[model samples]
Target: MTALPDDLARALDDALDRVPASRLAPVVERLIGDYRGGVATVSSRQGPILRTDDDAAAYAAYRMPATYAAVHDGLSRAAEVVGRLAPRTLLDVGGGTGAAVWAASRLWPSLRAATVLEGSEPVIALGRRLATGADDAAVRAARWERTQLGAATTLPEADLITVSYVLGELPEPVRETLVDEAAARASTVAVFEPGTPAGYRRILAVRERLIAAGMGVAAPCPHDGACPITGDDWCHFAARVDRTSRHRSLKGGTLSHEDEKFAYVVATRAPGQHADNRVLRHPLQRKGLVTLRLCTGDGAIADRPVPRSRREHYRAARDTGWGDAWPPP
Candidate 1:
C-alpha cells in the first residue's frame, strides 16, 4: 500500500472542503455509471466524463487517491528493477487532476519539469489549482494543457510518460496510436487501468505494441516474451488507499480504506534488470508450508511451496505479498 504524501493529502483535503459533498455525490454517482458503462464516443449523446467544475471536483475527490496509489506502486516496482531512474522531465497524457504527476514526483525527486495533457478544461483548471499547493516545485510549476488525445495527437518528448486510468475512455485505434506515440516520445512509459478483464486485455495489447516498438519492459512482467497466465485469470495488482473524510462522504462508504485493483506495464527504451519471478497471488500459508504462485522469467506460471525446513527461504516467502518479486528481490 502506498500513501499519498502529507502535503499532497492536505492539498486534496483543502480542495475538497470548497465543494459540498452533497452536490458532488450525485455527480460522483453519474461518473461511476459513466465509467462502469464505458464512456461514449465523442460524437455520442453522452459526451465526455468531466463536463463541469463539480464533475471535475467529484472525479478528483473520488479517484485521485486510488490513481495515485496505483501509479506509485507501478513506479516503485519499476524503480526496483530499473534502478536510479533520474528522470528530469515527465509527460502525463490524459492526466486528469495531475494524480500521476504527484506519483511520479514522489518516486523520482529528480523530476525538474512536468506537463499534463488533459482533454477537459475543468479538469486542467482543477488540477492546476491543486498543484499550486504542492511542496514539489516540479509539480507546482507543471504545465497543464488541454489537448484532445487522438490518433493525430503528437506527444512531446520526455524522460518519462505516464498514462493512468485513461485508455478505457478511448477507442481501440486511438489507444494503439497513443501508446505507440508514448513509446516513441519517452524513454520510460508507465500505463495503468482498472483491474477488470477488459483492462487486462488492454494492457496485454499495450505490452505487445511496446515490445514491437523495440521497448523493453521494466516491471510487472519479468520477461517481455509473452504473458503466460492464460484462461480466465487476468494480470492485475491491488493498491490500498486510505480514504479521506470527503472521499468516504462522496463515495458513501463506511470503510476507512479501499483497495484499487489495477493493471499496469512499465516499459523503458533501454533494457534493465528484471525480477526472476513475479508473485501472481497472495501467498497461502498453511501449517509449515507456504504456497506461492509466480510468473517466472521463462514465461511460465508455477506454484512453488516453501517449507519451514528452509528457514531463510520460508521466512522470505511468508513475508512476500501479492505482486511482490519472489526471493525478496
Candidate 2:
C-alpha cells in the first residue's frame, strides 16, 4: 500500500487529536448499520446529512484516508493516458472534507487555487480545519464554499474537476444536471463512486452523457463508444490502503490493510492515446502459460494467453496486475 501524502497524513493526525478513535467508534458502527440497512441512500432533496460535529469528525477520520488514496491513484492513472497536463485551478463538487483536492494538489503542483463546494456545515468546517496545518500554501488557503448542487448552481471554470463519491447520493435529474455543469465548466472531469453494481451503472450513465457533450473518453475505456461490460460485471479498480491503529479500532477490523474498490471515469475535452487493452482481472499463471482477461481497445473482452515459448510477453503477463493497462512495461 502507498503511503498517504505527508500533508494529508499530518492533517489526519491533527484531526485525530480532536476526535479520538474511542469517540469515533460508535459513529462508525452506526454508519455501518445505516449502510447495511440501506438507509444511507442519497436524495437530491436532502439537506446536509452529517448534522452533528461528532458525525462530521467520525466521517473524516474513517473515510478520508481511503478516498484520498483512491482519488490519487485514479488521477495518476488518468495522467498516464492523457500525458503531460498542468491545470491551474480545480473545483471539487460535493467534496466532503476535501479529499479530492488534497489528491489533486499532490499530482498537479501547477494548480494555483482550489475550491471545495459542499452543503454540510460541519463537514466544511472540518475540511477547513484539516487544511489549516498543511505545508502547501495553496492547499492551506484553499477556499471552502457552502453551496448546493442543482440546475441553478453556477460553477467556476477550472482545468480539472472531480466529483467523487457524491453522484450516487443524488436523484437522476440532479445527477444529470451536475454532470452537465461539470462538463461545461472544466476541460477535464473525473467522477468516482462506490464499486457496487449500482455505482458502475452510475458511472456508465455519466460516461455516455459526457461523450455526448463532446468530451473524449480519456482512460479505462480506450474508445468513446458503448461500454462492453454488461450485467454482473462492473468496471472497477482496487486500491490497497494501510490502516492506522486508530482506523482498525474505529471499524473493529483485525487486518492492517484494506482494499477500497471504486468505479471511476476520467474524461477530457481533447482526444488522447488510450491503452490498447486494460487488464480486467489478475493474471493467472499455470505451468508454461499465463492467462489474462482484458478489455480490448476495440471494445470487446478477450482472454489472452502468453506462453513461456513467447518468453518476453510471458514474463510481462506474469508481472501484470489487475487494473493495469496491458502490454505491460
Candidate 3:
C-alpha cells in the first residue's frame, strides 16, 4: 500500500548522482537483463554484484525501488493477518540497501531498534549511508553488520525477522540451515522472493520448513495443509508501483508503472484466527455473476460462483481482491 518513502528516494537519487554515467549505464543494463530473466548473476560462483561504489549505486538504482515495493506489500499482508502488533526490535537478513528495514519500519512505526546483516561492505556502507537519511528514528539509527549468513550462523532474537530477495543465491543445503536458524530466533518470520517459479518454489520450501518447526502461516495461505497448488501453476502475488522517469529510462519501458510480482510467506509462532480461504486470483465478474478461485483450508482449490441473486455472496466476491482471504473484513 505504501510507495517508496520520500527520504529513501532522495538518498537513492544522491547515490545515483555520485555514479559516473559511463559506469552506471552498463550496470543498469546488465541489472535490467538479470532482473527480467529472474537470473541470480550475483549469487553465482563470482559472488555478489555490489563490489564497488558504482556497483552498489547501479544496483540500488535499478532494483531497490521494486524490491521495496514487493516487501512493503508482503509485510502489509502479514500485519493484516497477524493483527497489528508492532515489534520493538526487527532484524533484516541480507538487508541490501536496508530496503526491508525501511519497509518494516514504515509498516510498524513502533519499532525502536533495527539491525541489518549483509556480507558486502560496499553494500553495508551504501545501506548505512542511505539509512541515515530515513525519517524514522529507528531506521536512521539501525545497526548495519557485515557478516556471512550460513547454516552455522546464529541469528539474534527479535519479534519479527524479514528475509527478502536473498534465498535464490544460496545452495539448498545452506538455505535449509538458514531457515532453521531464522525460525529458531524469531516469533514471526517473513520471506519474499521474485515471482518466478523458482522463487515460488523457494518460498514454498521455507513455508513447509517453518510449519514443521511449529510455526503457523499468517498470510497468503489459509492453512498448513500441503499446498493445494500443483502442476505448472505457482503461488504468487503482484504489487504495482509508479515508475520514476529514471526507472523507465533504465528499464527501457514506456509504461508509467510496473507490477512487481513476488512470492512470500509470513509465518508466526502463534496463528491468528481469520478467514479459511485465500482468493487465488482477481474475481472474475461477468453478467451478474462473480467467480472466485480459492485455496481453501480443506487443502483444495475451489471455484465458487456467486450470482446476483445471492446478494451477500455476490457482494463479497465482487469486492474481494486478489490475495485477500475470503470473508475478510
- The model with the greatest TM-score is 1
> What local distance difference test score does each model get?
0.90, 0.84, 0.84
Per-prediction TM-score: 0.97, 0.95, 0.94
List per-candidate RMSD values in Å.
1.4, 1.7, 1.9
lDDT of 1: 0.90
Off by over 4 Å in 1: 40-45
For residue 155, what is the lDDT in candidate 2?
Answer: 84
Off by over 4 Å in 2: 43-46
Clashing pairs in 1: none
What tens-digit string does per-residue lDDT give for candidate 3 at 18-123? 7766678788887666656645633543666567877778878878988899988877777777775578899998888888889889889889999998998988
Pairs that collide, model 3: none
lDDT head-to-head 1 vs 3, winner? 1
How many angstroms is residue 118 displaced in model 2 relative to the true structure, after the best TM-score fit? 0.5
- lDDT for residue 290 in candidate 1, whole number 0-100: 99
Q: Who is ahead in TM-score, 2 or 3?
A: 2
lDDT of 2 at 159: 90
Clashing pairs in 2: none
